[model samples]
Target chain A: MSNIALRKIFAMLVEKLARLEIFLEDKKETYDRPNLKFVISCEESLKEIKQDLLTIYPVLAKTFEGKVVSAEETQKALEVYKKCLDKFLELHSLSSHLPLNPIASETYIFLSDVLKIKKTFKEFDSRIVLLTQDFLTRNTHQCYTNLPFVSDIEKKPMALYLPIIENSNPLYWPILVKNIFGNIDSLKASAKKHYEELIGQKASLGQEKRKILEKIALQLTYDIYSMKLLGPAYYYLFVEAGVFRSIAETRIRYQPTLAAREQILFSELERQNFAAIAESTHKWFITLSELSDEMHSTLGFKVDFSDVQPAMDEIVARLTREAESVIPEKYLFKCSDFCVSLAGFERLKKGILVASSTIEELNKSKKQCKEALCEVNFTEKTEKLQELPNTPQQIINAGWIYSEYVYDDLLREVLKSPQLDYTPFIKHIKNNDTLLLNSVEKSRIFEILMKKEG
Target chain B: MLLNKKHIMERLVHADPDKKIFITPFINPEEQVGSVSIDLRLGTDFEIVKGFDSSSKPDFNVSAEKLEQMAVKKKVTVSADPAEPFYIQPGAFVIGYSIEHLKLPSDLLAKIAGRNSWGKIGLFVNSTAGLITPDFSGTLTFGLKNMSPEALPLYPGVRIAQIYFHQTRNSGSVKTEDAGAGTCEVISGNIEC
Candidate 1:
């Protein structure tokens, strides 16, 4: 299939996703608490929905994966996925009020992702972007984190773990994208200003430099996130995650200093953060109780979270204007006018009542009611949320779901686009094991990649 | 001999902690157990073979490059909805977790099998590190691949696989080596060996 034909299919799909994202963001005049009984009764319907999606997935993947897909086939393929959305939306309408991300959000996320990826492809079709896994793994200052990054591994092939939450959740996609792009841009600056100082960018001896870099990293993460394009859920997720990371209960791991003290370590502990997990169904609803209270305390008039679009608009309108002189001209962070937020314990109880059958399961869990789950499995897929609040408002009452399709789409697009070239940089550096070699080895590699003078 | 539904339930509802076959959220306990096995739903967390983002692409090739170290530098674990599954593209192998956390007693060992229904569609489910041993803890990881020529949508909670229990005859309990090959803790951001 020509990229053009595939792109056409994606374009139509994006249009469909935009409509759904809008629908999800649109708060109902009055919300119906999500009921598990409905999901139980509708189990067959859900299976049928999966069947319907299966019809589309293979055809859709084929069109993108080198198979011939005509205009008609593409449309038929798209119709299949769209058909599932309508069915899910009908089911999701009642539960949209709950903190759970509507199942329909998956399609919306793919649209946002493809559009963003398409934009990047346009900017650097043949550019020398950082070979991430390779760069980090090969850099003497930092080699443990990426194995495949080293293109010439003669040893047995190894599998790399790409967490779907970090990869696909549209909430994290913007920062995920920017961090890669932004870090490279930052590395270029660091290479020049501080004589290419990235070995310990986060852990440098000079606290001042480390602080500035950390602040810059955080600011860039927040700025690069397209609030307008991704929507308020991601923004709330971003804020909630930031707040969660600040609290101590999480037991986020801290790595001790490296012997050379040459580079800063970006541990997995950071991403396992509250901001990321808060997006999980179980955590979001519970976290909303406090988050809403915080917003009520700070924003004053916006109590109850009956509607947040207007307030969000006012804040963005004011901030974007004030920060206009600073933010990049081409990129603007925006949010949908979709209004949804903060359904309380009362609504939660009402939601649970619908699933009368789940009372047995909730009753089974009563012994552990007081203990809120400390470590929520990223997907909330753990059969027994051992530590989660074992109230009537458990899995059935609270929605437990997030997107999984976006990453597949992203992976497919990346594999097809192009194999990045690094022969020039590789040829310049002579030695492979450079730990014994001096700090000069680090500069040589970056200098060649950046085309800098020694 | 394989434990039947009646025997399986006995271990499941067993009062003694040492005798219990601990599986969480058994859901409809009656429905999950089959004549000789119990169904395991797909979990939300997954680890795909793909590496992290492109920007972190390192510039050099290596003979001693440890894939685990490289993976850590990149943020790349995935969580998906049961409805919107990660398509296990034909020929692509992925590690999927069972929604049920299993902790078998020393007397019981479990074997994972691809549901006959999924097998008809060319999905073969197996564990890389082999049969789940007694005393094994943590969510079970299934090696899912589409044997068919096309990409197949894999949803979480679709009882894609089934696991049957076996009672060990030996009095001496074998040390349960994790049936996973360095798969766990990918969520905690650390890849455990």
Candidate 2:
């Protein structure tokens, strides 16, 4: 069949399968058992078809065992595969609106797409292999080995093509004629060693010597990155380090000592702080464990709190059980002391386990309050607060109203006398008063006093 | 008439009751309200003007888009405690914004001024773009210049500027057509001079 005819048939099949999946999904809700079986059957059939197609797919590679096949035939196969890939992509996009099971569809789509990529890359690999074999056998292809910017050109033929293909370095011819025979892992290791050397040189250079170091590192990275032999880890490290270094250099240039010093200090401080926090946490855990042990000994029972960090409620339950059921009245004093002497008892008393200590503290506070209140002298000394000049400036100068007690006393006195106009007092409070009041309180006072005047 | 403390408080009590007048994280009256104006705190974002050649006149013919490329923007997060600060060196100019985003009423116009405390240290701000017209909304941008011999540390969330709100008898609209014109949008960059 013609390539176009095959592509059309493949596209139609994909479309039909997507529609069938969607139909099965819709009917699955109503006929759960039967529809599920039908869906599974359809899926299995589709899988088998996909496998059959994969098995029969002709190798588009232009060579077998060091012999070159016709270039025209290889090119025609590539064109047919390219057309099929385009149709698959179209079908994939169109099926997006179908209500297929999301997980199943995604897994299938990913699997198919990955297979396509593998097949394409395999063809690419085959082309390289053929070209390499051709270069070795034919003297005419020997000039291609003189490609510039390739390190140990005989060992890393893939690296030469990488830069031209990825970075589009026009200085070198595209390496389409051959596949590399060298192990990719060893090539990556060499490139990594090369990178380490570049960075080592960069590290030794001072601020003034950075420009040349950066230029060299960038050039080396460009060459390696174009090769595409290195994994994502190497790619990310190389790119991120280069960008970060450039930015750091720029900042160092502008601020001289300050910017560089700040960054170093920040990094050091962060490291130290994280270490300190870890140490502190470890100490705290040990302290808690020791405390728990002490409690266990005091109770004279093996509390099965093997949990490294039991919930607070669980600890409370255990403590309460020990306090109420296990301990005698004589031991109450010991438990009370534990609760009262230690901090955090105030917040933890809500659980009812620490009620005894809370009651003791409250009783003490009540007695103290009563004693203090009894000492207040209420024998009315009719000594009036000396009235100052009513002017705003004089009132501010006296600083009497600024005092919280005095302001309250004065306001009380003014309110008692109906004849006294509270305008000046109100004005002073409105303008000069810096007392912290809630919005509701401030507005209520100001609205009654200022609104009448306005 | 300049709004006094009482008037300011009264207006705030009822002002934008539903929409909140767009001031983010509003402060209580006691914290920010002054006798004559409400204090505005410094924001974290800043645009610092780079040093230029004093020999050549800056090309004014550069478009608004081009002028935006000239200034370098920096965001300096300042701690609430006054100990850590973003320093501004002598003979340096930087742009800062108020932490609060205010939406002024149609009858109320505002003016930005350096606090007396900041001005005493030879830290000048808002020499230009001081006027905030009525109906203006957004964080006000500040043109900060440190004229002191010593480097001044500016802490964000501290009182850097005061905004005196004035009530106008004539509620005429302030022209905003030319407001954002030639204004640089990005936090920092050099203009096409």
Candidate 3:
């Protein structure tokens, strides 16, 4: 045989073996039955074959000059390979029929090792072909008899055949029959190679081939067991099994290329940088509200000395109206108080306007507050604030003090409460038109009154 | 206005002179108190008795003597342990029965408040029935749902809630006459005697 012909034959044999490996893996993955013990044993035997193959792989590559051989002198070698293939098919079929008994499990492993040796042969020739054909035919006959077991599950009768004369696709039938024959032939060839390596004196080569065959067998057994165990509810299991089989088969066929791509993507993600923003907008608003309330009380009532009762009534009415409307609930309480202050002719009318406007301005100011409340910027200010031990206990403990400017700005805008008679403060503002009642001084007067008995 | 702990304590102890009231301090208080509201706590003892028929109210009469004994002794024992006892674990919470069986005056209304100290530890108190009717007498049951993830352990004899007395106008005879008459009619309808 020419080198090209030899190469083609070797490639065909490898393809057949690959197909068998896939079939076994699929069977193992889908296997799920009370008789999983047999599947388990078959799987273990295949695992040994797979390991043996791994060891013999480099040696096979070296012998074949990095390629499988094709030559006339290797005929006898191919015969040994055929016998190995026959034994493998027989073991698989027989194991599938019998229960997972220990004795049957040992017999399956013995056949698997015999098959492993045949897979290591480096030649494809006529003499090897004859031996392989003979063993293959014998195994196929045995497999035909075992087909009844599976056929019974399918509710099909054994030995039922349609006449060729009446067949619509007679030519297609012959081709189908030929393909089946060819598949069996390929199985025989690979089996012969597998057995040669198994029985060979070279322990390391045998070990490697054994491991590869074992893995393939175990994979098939697992698939079969899973299928039987899971019953009808094994859709997801089957999908996962399919994916695993695809990945494994792809890895075996194209090892370095696929792995390199995965490595590159992983490295890229590892070298990337990211950041996150943290801000408590709700807490800030709460603190601001508290400060506004304090400032309102401190500023004293913005009541007019003249017609105080009527003004208070009008304030109440306005508050009720505002409350009835869709204005925010927070503004409802403040609106009544603001109206009352305005009615009372109180000082700090400008402050009241600012406080009232704060509600409308809240949407815009929210953005400003979010930016200002960052922890990094406040760290220094917080340190300085902590240093100020001389501050009043109330001031130090107040939540508003933590963010003074935000609260102070809000508080400075609130109109004084109408309940306080701020006539003197009003007079001072009117007469001077410049001197305003400072918050500190107002806070003191309010503090004294708060301490006094009502 | 600006009531502190001392002021609150004094008010609770001395506010009502005509009515005799008791103030029991809970050492490891579980009730939470807010600025104005008090959160109630679940008591240690719980019972999962068979549900009573909707057609009839619970037969408190059968257990009246035992209840009286419990009230006098300030302790009651229950039979048939709960499947789980709905444990208000060390930091967990469970609903509890209030010790107070209040009879509100026609002119006044009272609201229960949770203690302030308990609120600091993140306990929450709430009740579905806020108003105490003038003729009410049974012990009030608080739905002491714990908002905190931690189990709030409680035991018998713990004061889990405080009753706040609010004074309302008498509204003279017009309001009281109608309300009192309606209640009397309902009681008469329910009891054959």
Candidate 4:
């Protein structure tokens, strides 16, 4: 095929990426995208790009398909984006503006950050897709590639685990990149090349296993792509997913001979780890909120001095009426008394390299906290280790599912009804539990609790 | 008195914290505001009864302790994913929770039922008595017994049930944990005591 489908998809991909570009209005982006034709048609005829696009199109489509973009196009766009950028860079001067699409800004940062290349573009009209997604894709077309619980739980471990710990991470670039480039810098020049390399490598696994592995690899990429729209709450859910590296005892061995009976359970340590992680997330959030409360009381139109300090406890319902402030992780608890001096507030804000929970992050993430709080993990350990069938996606999911049971029944004690106060109900619930109430439920609770203020 | 939409909205955001009705994921307030009854999404969890031995059958003569132990092993919980739904065959009964987590203030009470449209589809979300008392907080669970001959899909996340809220006289009864969580776990589909 002439890659006609791939070209059509990428052409449409511009519209989807543009949505995310809208998020980066921060850098004062005035440069408009060139025509779609100019963007995709420039190198449409390249024979080598066709194979890669065809394979990757479907994957991208699962994540990026919108009114202008189709899932098929998204998959292709994802696989083809880097290569297209490589070609674009090869053809143009370093300073030439990206002639591609609106997501050029995001892709620029995403590509550079993932490849470990340190390049900053201050004037570029760049946007990382600002819309927070469910870290797992429920907003887009649902695609479950034969993984257990893929329909409900997050699709990949790597995406789930890294969002939070990495959120406040020193290399905030990975979280900012949104897309999971996943150490892909050295895989190969292109997807087609990767396929060739895959076929050639691990020859001892046999041709059948190798082919299955390649299929799994491609599917995994789309799964990660699905999480590209992750917001801050997505990061905090690393422990909520209850699976992955933290669960040290989790053993998910490959089951080639048996059906999909993968035996996995959470040990005592994993549960403790979950509790520790949950407490950390809760502490980080409450401290952030306290800082928000402090910011609200200190700045802006406030004309009073005396009661405004003590009255803040009465007025700021989780700082919904007024809020903004984040401190580095080390100093998260320092502002325990949110009634800080403006100097102290600035001091807290300046120490933010370790603090990932900003006002924006808290707002986006709090939506999930309620749901996390309300959820009941009826997680029961299996009586015996059962062997599940060995599928490639199973292997990929097993990467985390072994650890998946990590979040079992831990948050059951946390009450659902928030202590009704001047604060909104959701904040009280967050104060109440570490398990979660889904975002919709949490927001609903927020509305319900806020009713008292009215 | 049965609270109308206006009263409901007022109570929803009542100035007094004790008088509000909290039906969350109250997804579309404007849409929900149009009617007196709040449409509730089906919750994620459903429990299917595993065939138990004759000894496992409930009898009034049996002690509550044995019944409690048997209840745990006699049923399997299935979490329905929005991507793929769980199918309930004809004449089958499954216990399910409303996706909308509700927490009524001390002064309010609620009644839950299968939505008329869902009732037509042979899915009965009727509670044992349909009455939820004051100060309840948790997903409302109800018995969803399929009366249709064909297997009916129990899709979570849709408006499967509708809840009507009411104002109580002399309210302020303290809540017992999950006093109105809407199910008797030991009794399976039995009404809460």
- RMSD, each candidate, Å? 28.5, 33.0, 38.8, 27.3
Question: What's model 2's TM-score?
Answer: 0.29
Which segments of candidate 3 are over 4 A away from where they belong? A1-454, B1-44, B47-86, B89-94, B100-106, B115-123, B134-138, B148-151, B174-193
Best by lDDT: 1
Query: Under the 3 Å rule for N, CA and C atoms, how many clashes does model 4 have?
Result: 38
- Clash counts for all predictions: 42, 18, 104, 38
Give per-residue CA lDDT, model 3, range A251-300, as digits (tens).
23211121221122122212221000102112322322232222233333
Question: What is the DockQ (computed on Cα atoms) for candidate 1?
Answer: 0.01
Q: In TM-score terms, which candidate is top?
A: 4
Output the TM-score of candidate 4: 0.35
Cand. 3 TM to true fold: 0.19
* CAPRI quality band, candidate 1: incorrect
lDDT of 1 by residue, A1-454 (tens): 2433334333323333333333333433235444444444345455666466445555556756677776566556535644654464455434422212222222222223223232112222112122222322232111111112224523221112124323333223333333333344443443233322332433424544444343333332332232332333433333333332222112222211111010111111122232222233233333333432332333232212113223323332333343333334433321101110111112122221111112323333222221132222122323331211111111111211211112234435433423312122122111110110111111112122122211
Candidate 2 chain A has its poorest 10 consecutive residues by lDDT at A385-394
Q: Tell me the tens digit of each residue's lDDT in model 2 across A1-454.
A: 2232232222223333443454555656776675566556555554554443343133211121223434454344334433433333333333332222221212122222222222112224344434433332221111111112122223445654665443321111113212321332343444344434444444544554344333332333322322122111122222222222222223222211212222222232233222221221232223223322322333342222122112222222332332233223322222112212221122121111111112323333233323232231222322121111111111111121122113333333433444322343444332222211111112222222222323
**Model 2, B36-130: lDDT tens per residue?**
88888775556666643345555668885655554344544332233446789998888887655566655555678988988899999772565
Poorly placed runs, candidate 2 (over 4 Å): A1-454, B15-22, B51-58, B63-66, B72-82, B169-193
- For every prediction, compared with the true complex, DockQ reads 0.01, 0.02, 0.02, 0.02
lDDT of 3 by residue, B36-72 (tens): 4333333333432223444555567768555433332
TM-score of B-chain for each predicted structure, in order: 0.74, 0.74, 0.46, 0.77
Cα misplacement distance, residue A185 of candidate 3 (Å): 99
lDDT of 4 by residue, A1-454 (tens): 1132333224323322332233233223444454343333333422334444445544433323322545444434533644543443332222122222222222222222222321111111122212112222221111211122123323343445445534222223333333333323322123234444534544455555444434333422332222112211322222211111111111222211100000000111123222322332343333223322222333221122222222222222222111112112322211111111111122122221111112222222233323253232222333111111111111112112111221111111111113211122222222222112132122222232233223
